[model samples]
Target: MSTPQMIRTPLTELTGVAHPIIQTGMGWVSGASLVSATAEAGALGFLASATMTIDELERAIVAVKERTDKPFGVNMRADAGDAEARARLLTKYGVPVAGFALAPKQALVEQLKSDGIVVIPSIGAVRHAEKLQAWGVDAVLIQGGEGGGHTGAVPTSMLIPSVVSAVDIPVIAAGGFYDGRGLAAALAYGAVGIGMGTRFLLTSDSRVPEEIKRRYLAADLNGTVVTTKADGMPHRLLRTDFVEGLERTTGIGRLVDSAKRGLEYRRVSGMSWIEYLRDGIAMKKATGRSLAQMAQAANTPMLLKAGLVDGDTSAGMLASGQVVGLIDDLPSCEELVDRVVREAAERIRAAGATLVG
Candidate 1:
């Protein structure tokens, strides 16, 4: 099929991509191969850097640059101790965008803007979106309750228009989005674009284990669950046996497991105990999470890596959107993006034809 005619939006104009679709930065999933392929396919892609060391992140950034000349972004942890250094890397390498999962400090926004880097933070609430807009962010990616990973309780249907109306900047709707029809719906709701995590994670270019990908494909609409048992924060995950067990376990049992995972995470991440404490403290202040919650949250990275990278479905948790139920095939990024754009355009045209003058 011919390439779909481009659909222009504030996001397309701002990011210089042919499509307004964005592939979210999912830890252990959105690596250079996936990001580069998505960029080449004319969608904005973000490399997940929160799981990478500074040097590893730089290497991944360089690798993406080597693979694709198109603009792409890096997703970062704003409160990370090395946040400034990561920002500097983006500036130094002339990366086009910087995406944050949490609201970054005002100074970081200013610093990126001064260096001509676009700042797009992922927010889950109207207040957060408004604050980021006031901080002069280029745009905001809003994930609703149905989104994977750490998520809020608000569904996209309500959250998208709410944030869009509350802020002047473009809003990219995430959570429960997977197809051209969904993209059309988001536009109808006043969003400039759509951001997809589970959709992108299932793509052919994603580095997730094939076994894990197959597991995602087999999921149905009810395959996912949002539970705080994972890290004391509401996280949407595939209802795997491991996650089910987690839900069944008492608080004490879960805490012990979290502690073990936290240590494993520290060892694998090369963080000293002091550095880990600093990060935990930072998390405590940022999210107002108690010490126990912070400890559980610290283990999340490792838990995800175990599933996505190591293919340990028994013990590792699979972060996923409810859209997992809707996904079946693993098309390459190019094919997937083109198909979505084409389908959306056709749907929009059909919808317009039915309108009365």
Candidate 2:
């Protein structure tokens, strides 16, 4: 079949991508390969940099540039110790976009915008979106409860329209979105596009291990559970033996485990104890997370690495969206983007036809 004509929206116009689909930056899953492929396929992709050191992130950025000249983004924690330095590195490379998991400071947003980089932050609440927009962010991506990892209680259907109505900036809807039908619905709801995490992570171009991919594929719609057991915040993850054990553990036991993981992370990340403490303090000030929650935050990357990179499901946790059950195949990024765009155009046209004069 001939390729479907490209559908342009505010997101596509701002990001310079042919399609409005966004492949979210999933730590340990989103890397150079996936981001480049997504960019080449005419969608925006973000390199997950929160898990990487500043040097690693620069290298990853260079790797993506080598693979594709298309515009892409790098996702980072706004409160990271090296955030300023990372921002400078992005400027050095002339990266097109910068994405933040948490709301960045006004200064950081200004710096990126001045450097000609589009700043898009992910938010879970309408207030957050309004604040980001007021702070002059280029756009915002809002993830609902059905999305993977840390999520809010509101479903996407309700959350998208709420934030869209509140913010003048472009809004990209996430959570429970995986295909063309979702794209159409998001646009109808006033969003400029849809951002997908789990759907992209399950793609053939993603670097997630084969075993881990199989595990994700086997899950049914009911296979995901949202629990605060992994971290102090509500995190959505696959229902695995490891996750179940975490849910069953007492608060004290979990705290002890969190301490252990925090130490392990410090070692793996090569951060001095002083540096670790500083980062913890920054996280506390930014998110208002308690000390215990700060320690538990260390568990997220380590556990995800074990499952997504090492393929050890028993030893690690898998962050996934409720949409996992809806996925069955591992199509390449190009094919997936093409199919979704085509289907969205057709659905939108069909829906418009039903409107009475």
Candidate 3:
């Protein structure tokens, strides 16, 4: 198909991309191939750095640079012990944007901005949006309850307008968004763009295993469930036998499993015990999780790796948005971006035509 006409918005302008679509960073999913393809397709893509070690992240960034010259961002954990180091790496590479899953400290934000990087943080609430804006972030991406993994309780319809009204900075609406209609709706809600995670994770360019992608396609609207069993926080995931078992498992049993996974993750990540402890302490201080919850935190990476990377749904959990039910095909990044932008533009025009003279 021919390329669709560009849909310009503050998001496109701020990030220097041709379209207002953003392929969000998903652990074990968004990598060099996906990010570079999204960039070449004229939408901003964020590399998921939260799952990568510092060296791995640098290599991934270099890989994307080698593949495409289009501007893209790197998403990292703001609460990570090496957050400052990560920020400096972005600066060193001249990455145009820096995204944080958690709000970074004001100093960190300033440092990135000083280096001419646009800082965008993902926030779930209006208060968090306000706080990030106060720290001079370029934009905020708000994911509502319907989003996959570690989501809040509010739906996108309610959350987007609330945060848009609360903050002057650009807002990108996420959660439950899959098609162009969702993009049109978000723009109508006063957002500058839409951010998609599960949608992108299902794309052909995504590095997720093919079988796992099939499992996502098989799901219907009711295929997702929000549960606190995955970690200490509420996570939206596909309803599977393994996840159900997690819900049924006793707290002590869960803790023991978490410990085993944590040790495995430590070995795979090549982080020393001291480094792991430092990261754990930073997470505890940032999130105020109890020791048990801290242990559970380790379950996230390893479990996500099992399903998303290893395609072992029997032993791993899959994080997915409610929109999985709405998706059926695995289009490439170019086709997906073009279709969504085209549909959104058509919808907007159709809405305008309804206005009476």
Candidate 4:
């Protein structure tokens, strides 16, 4: 069979990928299996390192490399204690990209740049794109509010043009992009391609449990809600009874539990408890999030890992996009990517006719 031609963007050429599409780094869910599959299908895939230890990240990189000879990225917490170790693996393993899951410091950017790793931090606003670009990032992935997991407030339609207009580097649009029409729209807005989290989460390559996946499919357009009750900033999640319970909780119990979890995260991750609190304070200072909310933020990802990886639905929280309502079937990574690219190409051509007249 002849390979269908795609309108390769500068990013595609720069990263040695066919399309400019990327799979968003979902904590625990975006592991070796999903990341390798996407990379093998010719789109950049990011290994979610937010929950994984540095050694675990090393194993994941090797595991993906063993599965496919294609290039893939590893996503890391920008302020993580062992971020430098992940950077070392990127240089040692020749990882194609280093994706930042949070606001990165200048030192982290320099550490990766000196090793020749292409740094691309996912951003939700225009200023962030400019900030990363100024720090010598190669590209930016902008996730609009329609995106799943923890997301920004702006919608994809506005964020795409906003970030693209602000930065000279390649901009990848994300959020609520489940099909070719969405991908086509992103290109029209001047994005190199689209990035997807929920779309990828619903794919067969993703290792999310059947029951959880089904719950996501059962959600309605209004099923997802933004709540800072789980983490510091607004987080998009499936509106589950468990989630509602947390949001409704008051008094000393909530505060005590949050403090305990924060300590546990610090210990397990090899960070001093005081340092963990300091990080929370710093994040609060930077984002203007309240002290209580920042304390809650320290433990959110660990809770997410329990649900996503361990399938402990009762204990873990589900971070999802509002688009889960639109998803019904789980297609293989290859099938999903091909369908999206094909449909987008057709749509783009059809739209051209209207403009020419």
Clash pairs for candidate 1: none
Name every residue pair that clashes in candidate 4: none
Residues 135-196 of candidate 4: C-alpha lDDT, one tens digit per residue: 88888888899877788888889988888888899998888898999888889999998888
Model 2, residue 278: C-alpha shift (Å): 0.9
Q: Which stretches of candidate 4 lie over 4 Å from their true place?
A: 1-5, 267-290, 355-357
Tens digits of lDDT, candidate 3, 136-161: 99999999999998899999999999
Instruction: Show model 1 residue runs off by greater than 4 Å.
Output: 1-5, 352-357
Error of 4 at 289 (Å): 4.4
lDDT of 2 by residue, 1-357 (tens): 224446899998999888999999899888999999999998999999988877888999999999999999999888888788888988999899999999999999998999999999999999998888889999999998999999989999999989988878999999998999999999999999999999999889998988889999999999999999887899999999999998999989888888887788888777888888888888889999987888899878888888888899888999999999999999999999998999999898788555477
Q: lDDT value for candidate 3?
A: 0.92
* Candidate 3: regions farther than 4 A off: 1-5, 352-357
CA lDDT of each candidate?
Answer: 0.91, 0.91, 0.92, 0.82
Top model number, lDDT = 3
TM-score for each model: 0.97, 0.97, 0.98, 0.93
TM-score for candidate 4: 0.93
